[model samples]
Target: MYPDELERYHRQLLVIGREAQEKIRRSSVLVVGVGGLGSIASLHLAAAGIGRLVLIDNGKVELSNLQRQILYTVDDIGKPKVYSAAHRLSELNPGTSIHPIYADATPELLREVISGVDVVVDGLDNWETRIIVDKICYELGKPYVHAGIHGFYGQLYIAWPGKTPCLRCVFPRPPRRGNGDVIPVFSTTPGILGLLEANEALKIISGVGKPLLNKILVYDGKTGLFDYVEIRDADCRVCEE
Candidate 1:
C-alpha cells in the first residue's frame, strides 16, 4: 500500500487498516441505474477505493434530476448518466477504475459486466428491472444491497444469494400498475436511501461491519425512526429458499 492511500483512508483504515483497505482496492462493484440512487451509491464506492466500478444507466440527466441526483449538476442536464458518472467518478477518485456502459443495461446486459464484480447495488427505480436482476444475481450467487424510497420512508436490505432472502422473497413479483400507486418522494428521498445503500456496500466490501442481511431497515424521515423487519420466508422463488 502506498503511504498516501493509508493517509487517504485513515479513518476507515483506522480499525481494519491496510488489510481491509487492500480488500477494497481488489474488489469491483456493478452499480445498475445511474439515477438518483445509483448516482450517490456509485460516488461513495469510488471514493472508498473500490478497485473497479461498472456503471450502467440508459437515461440522460434531466432538469428534474438536479434536486437529488448528486452525480450530475445543472450543466449535465442532457448528457447520459453513465458517461457523466464515469467522468465524475474518475475525477473523484483517480485511484479507482471506472467502466461506463452507456446503454440500456438490463439483466442480460449485466451478465457480461457482473462476471468479475464483488457486490451489486440496486439503484434502479423500476421493480421489473429489479426482479430481473435479482433473479440473475441470486442464480449467480452474488450479494446485493437494495433500497427503495417513497416520500420520507425508505427500505434497505442486503441479500446474499441462497443464504439470505432475495428481493423476490420479500416482494414475490413486481407490483402491478396502479397497485401501490405512484408514491411521491421528496428530492432527498432517493438520496437518503442511496446513502444507506452505500453504507451497506462499504460494510460488505470491507468486511468490517455487519450488513443488513435478512432484515429490511425502514427509515421514516419525518420521525427519524429506523426499524427493521426480519425476512424469514425461506420459500421464495428468487431466493430459492
Candidate 2:
C-alpha cells in the first residue's frame, strides 16, 4: 500500500490486518443502483479502499433523494446518479478507482458488468432488478450481498449461489405489495442496511469473517429489534442444476 493509502485506512487496518487489507485493495466490487442503499454502500466501500468500485444507475438525483441519499447534494439534483456518486466516492478515497455506468440494468448489460468483479452489492429498490442481478451473479459464480429497506425496517443476507440459498429460493416470489402500492420508508432505514451491506462486502473481500451466506438478518428501527433467520432451499430452481 502507498504511504497515504496506509494512513487513510489506518483505523480499519488493525482489525483486518495488512494482508487482508491488501486483498481489499486488490478486489473489485459492483454496486448496483445509486439510490439510498447504493449511496451508503458505495460511500463506505470507497472509504474502505476497495480497488475498483463500479456504480450502475440510470436515474437522476431528485430533491426527495436528499433525505437519505447522502452521496448527493442539492447541486447534484437532476444530474445522473452514477456521475454524482462517482465524484463523491472519488473525493472520499483516491486509492479506490470509481467506474460509473449510467444505464439501466438488463440481462445483457449485467453479463458484461459482472465480468471481472469480485462481489455484487444489492442496492436496487425493486425485486424485478434485484432478481435479475441475483440470477446473473449465480450464473457467473459470484458472491452477492442482498439487502432491502422499508418503513423503518430492513433485511439483508449474503448469498453464495450454489453454496447457499439464492434470493429466489428464499423469496420464491416477490412479496405481496401494500394496498397503496407505495413503500413507506424512512431515510435511516436504508442507511443502516446499506452500511451493513458494505460491511458484509468488506468481510467477503478480506476473508476476515464468515459471510452471512445462508442467514437472513432483519432490522426494525421502530422497535429497535434485530432478527436472524437461517434459510435454505431444497428445490431451488436456480442453484439445483
Tell me each candidate's TM-score.
Answer: 0.92, 0.96
Give the C-alpha lDDT of model 2.
0.88
Off by over 4 Å in 1: 173-183, 235-241
Q: Write the per-residue lDDT of candidate 2 for residues 50-97, one digit (tens) a residue.
A: 999999899999998899999999999999999999999999888899
Query: How well does candidate 2 score on lDDT at residue 50?
Result: 96
In model 1, the Cα lDDT at residue 33 comes to 90
| Candidate 1, 41-110: lDDT as tens digits | 8888988899999888888999877877899988888998899899999999999999998888666788
Off by over 4 Å in 2: 180-182, 232-241
Deviation in angstroms for 57 in model 1? 0.3
Candidate 2, after superposition: displacement of residue 220 in Å?
0.7
**What lDDT score belongs to each candidate, Candidate 1 first?**
0.83, 0.88
